[model samples]
Target: MTLKTEPFVLNMGPVHPSTHGVFRMRVVLDGEVVTDMEPVFGYLHRGIEKLAEERTYGGIIPLTDRLDYIAAMSNNFGYVLSVEKLAGIKVPERAEYIRVIMAELQRIASYLIIIGAFLNECGAYFTPFVYMFREREKIIDLFEMVSGQRLTYNYMRVGGVSQDLPEEFLPALDKFLAQMPVCIDEYDRLLKENEILLARSKGVGILSKETAINGSVTGPALRGSGVKWDIRRADPYSIYDRFEFDIPTGSAGDCYDRYRVRVEEMRQSLRIIKQAREQMPAGPVRTKVPHLVRPPVGETYAHIETPKGELGFYLVSDTSISPYRIHIRAPSLINLTVLRELIIGWKIADLFVIFGSIDLTMGEVDR
Candidate 1:
């Protein structure tokens, strides 16, 4: 005699530890395997675009900080660059270098959380998370030294940065730069070869090159799929063209490959920062601009490589102090598009592993 079984429905989040934030995945499971998934979001939505329409051009900078809260500096850079391009404002050369420095530092801090969170989801306990958090504090200290805020740094401005780098910030940054490589090497030795981690993550949730590009997945997720497309390399913005760094790509396009891509990216970010520091010149951090900035009647779009992916800001101006329409090309939301395709054949236990590997922040996904 034989018994018949039916698929059961399970809710993964909306408020679960591994979901990362108010994200929910309605998964249909046949025993332990996930057969189908419906991703449900909007729990954390704040209507940021509508708010941007109401705020002054300068006032919207702080609003951007809330998008990818983990990497607010990148959000600031994208929005300010869009506004500057629309208004024809020229940033000071020194300010450009400072911007690059801050952006790279933010990148490192964001990746520490991402990799740490991924390992945590893999059931490695708190060891890796705590270690990465310790290093992240040093970078946060650097940001505080310059921006006066730890998480939501509203330091970027229309024509330049809010202020110049302080006297002590450089020496602190130098110390961090000197120590970061050793920490990275230690982390690699600790986790990369663990037999358990390998068994769980290797070749799981594979996203092909064709799928990644067609789905518009960018940043480390796209790079992990063997597509060497980086916004900084493909489309140079600010002083990125002047600096030297390599775009890291993965061949397997699996969960492990995504993890490896982020690790290599941190190294590349450090390289760019070192070059920017050496080439940094002395000058004012900002150019003079009116309190109420009204750009010409036009539309503009600008994007930056944030920790999650390519974050873009699009604006329509009517020659007013506020934008006529504003839209954000949020990578978190776009990357989620491919989730169903990747998780279909994996087991329920592998669900969170694959999800964490994507490195999404719900704030941006629901924004």
Candidate 2:
């Protein structure tokens, strides 16, 4: 005779390891399987949008640094581009190249954290995390050499970067570019085919292509769902059109495919950086803009492909030093919309593995 069981709810996080940050998951479990789920967020909200209205256009850059703090440079890129569009500011050629370089570097760095953290959630101990962080440290060192900040670079500004690359920066970057591919391969060799990781991740928590697009997911998560939409390729921000890179996609849209998409994206990011370094021209890194940047009363939207997804900034300027209104089309928030659908039928233990594959940053979600 079969025993009857009622659904039981399990609340994980708002302060759990696999939530990544202050995020909560309300799960209804029928024994070991998840029958329904609700993603709870806003535990780390800082009112960044409300705060942007109170600050000058230039002052808003630093605040953007906090959103998706892992890919802070990409946050800077989106906000600055929106401001530049509103103000009719033109970025210098060299600054465009520098912005691409910094953004791509941030992409690889952020992916490192994603891959490492996902493996840890999959119960790989800390081995993969340690290996990825070793390479990530080199990229961070290169960023610090130019911007003098390790985590929040605040390096991009409207119409260009805050400053030019130091003379030594390029050579050091050249060294990093030379070594990153080998390190990536080493990660693949170490854990990509481990039976346990594959058992936990492969064919698990599959997100459909239609659901991903309709849900407004972007970046690797969307790409992992077999969608070929990358803002860099789709919208052509900055000099992205000038550079050539492949949009990597996955077949199954499962946790393993998401992992593969990010890993392949790191390789593609390296390719873009290499070509940018070879083709970059020498010129002023910034264009002059007044301290009080009063854009003509207008509205504009700008977005870039961050590690997590499409990060966009929409601005309404009223011919003042501060924006009349600002809205962030945060990828982290939008990507979580399908969380319940993805995990509803999966086992309870697979929940964190699937969540980690989505790779969210709570700062952006709560912003």
Candidate 3:
């Protein structure tokens, strides 16, 4: 006699730890295998775009901080770049180098979170997670020296950074740059060739290159699928054209490839920061502008290679202090478009690894 099986739906989260942040997944399962999945968003939405319309251009920087709280510096960079373009503001040379250094440091810090969380989801538990955070804390200390905030640093301003790096900031950053590569190497020695990690992640949840580009995935996720596209390299912004760094790509497009790409990218971030440090000159950090910026009636969009992915802000001005309309092309939400394609037919346990590989923060997704 043959037994009959029926598919059942399991709700993964709106509050579970593995969902990253208040995200939900309705999974159609056949026993332990996921047959279909629907990602549920909005649990964390705070109408950030709508709120931007009510705040002045300068005031909106804090709101962007809450979008991708893990990489708040990148959020600030993207928004300020958009506002500067809208107002035709020119940033100083020193400020541009400072921006590059901060942005690159933010990229490294954000990738640490992703790598740690991904390894944790793969069942390495807190060992790797804590190790990653140890380095991240050093980066955070450097940010605090400049921004005076541990998280949600509202550091980037409309013209440039809120202020020049403090007297001690560069020295702290130089120390970090010197020691970070050794730490990265230590992480590699510990887990890069672990048998268990290889078994769990390699050759799992592959996303094709064509699908990634068509879905508009960016950053490491797109690069993980063997696409050699990076906003910093593809379309230089600020003084990114002045720096030399390599874009890392993965061939298999699997969980392991994504993890490897992030690790390699961290090294590249260090390279960029080192160059910025060597090239940075002394000048005024912020350009003088009206207390309340009222751009000419026009619209502009600016995108940056945020740690999670490509974060773009589109602003429309009606010659007002506040934005006439604000729209965010949040990578967290866009990258989720490929979830169903990646998770279906995999075991429920594999779902976490695949999802974590994308490195999304629900704040950006639901915002």
Candidate 4:
């Protein structure tokens, strides 16, 4: 005799642990396999774009920090770049180099958090998570030295950084750069080829290159689908053109490929930071701009290769202290366009691993 199975509906979370941050997925399951899925967002929405209209251009810097709280520096970088363009401001040479260093360091730190959380979702639990966080904490220490805040660092300004690096910042950064490679290698040696990880993630949750592109996915997710597009190389922003680094792409676009891309990207970030450090010059970190910046009546858009993906900002000014309109091209939300397709037909157990591999923070999604 054979037993018949019926389909059931399940709500993964607006509160469940694996949704990453206030995200929910409504799934239709036939036993252990997910037959259909719908992603639910906006649980954490705060109407940030609307708020930008009320705040001065400079004041909006703090607001951007809240967009991707995990990679706040990159959020600040992208927003300030847009504001600078609208105002026709030029950043100082030294400030350009400093921005590159801070942005690259933030990339590594943000990747570390996602990688740790991804592994934890895969069932390795807090052991690997704690190990990765150990390195992330060191990066946080360096950030704290410069910005005095571990997270939500409103460090970048319209024409440059808000302040110069403190006396001990470089020495501390040097120490971190020296030790980070060893830690990365250690992580690779321990988990990269582990049988359990390979079995769990190797060929699961495959996203096709065409699907990724058509859906407008960017960053590691798009690159993991074997696309060689990186905004730093495709469209050079700041002093990224002055640096030498390789864009890492994955072949199969599976969970393992996305995981591998992030790990390799961390190494590339270290390379960029090293070049920025050696080529940095001494000059005023911030350009002289009015306290209340009033750009001519016009609009501008600026984007940067943030840790998760391409984060872009669009700003419109009407010669006022505050912006007339603001819109953020948030990668976290854009990248989720293909989530339902990726999750459908996969086992319930693989759902968390697949979703975690995308590496999205709800702060950006709900904004």
The digit string of per-residue lDDT tens for model 2 on 131-202 reads 889999999998898888999888888878878888999899999988999998988998789999999999
TM-scores for candidates 1 onward, in order = 0.99, 0.98, 0.99, 0.98
Model 4 Cα displacement at 50 (Å)? 0.3
Best by lDDT: 1
Per-residue alpha-carbon lDDT of candidate 1 for residues 1-367, written as tens digits (9 for 90 to 100): 8998878999988899988889889999998999999999999999999999999999999999999999999999999999999999999999999999989999999999999999988989889999999999999999998999999999999999998888999999899999999999999999999987898889999999999989999889999999989889898999899988999999999999999999999999999999999999999999999999999999999998889999999999998899999999999999999999999989998998999999899999988
Go through the candidates in order and give each one's C-alpha lDDT: 0.93, 0.91, 0.92, 0.92
lDDT of 4 at 159: 82
lDDT of 4 by residue, 1-367 (tens): 9988777999989998877789888899988999999888899999999999999999999999999999999999999999888889999999999889989999999999999998988889899999999999999998898898999888999888988999998998899999999999999997898888898889989999999999999999999999999999999988899999999999999999999999999999999999999999999998899999999999899999998899999988899899999999999999998998998889999999999999899999999
lDDT of 3 at 39: 89
lDDT score for candidate 1 against the true structure: 0.93
Pairs with backbone N, CA or C atoms under 3 Å apart (clashes), candidate 4: none
Candidate 3, residue 199: the lDDT equals 93
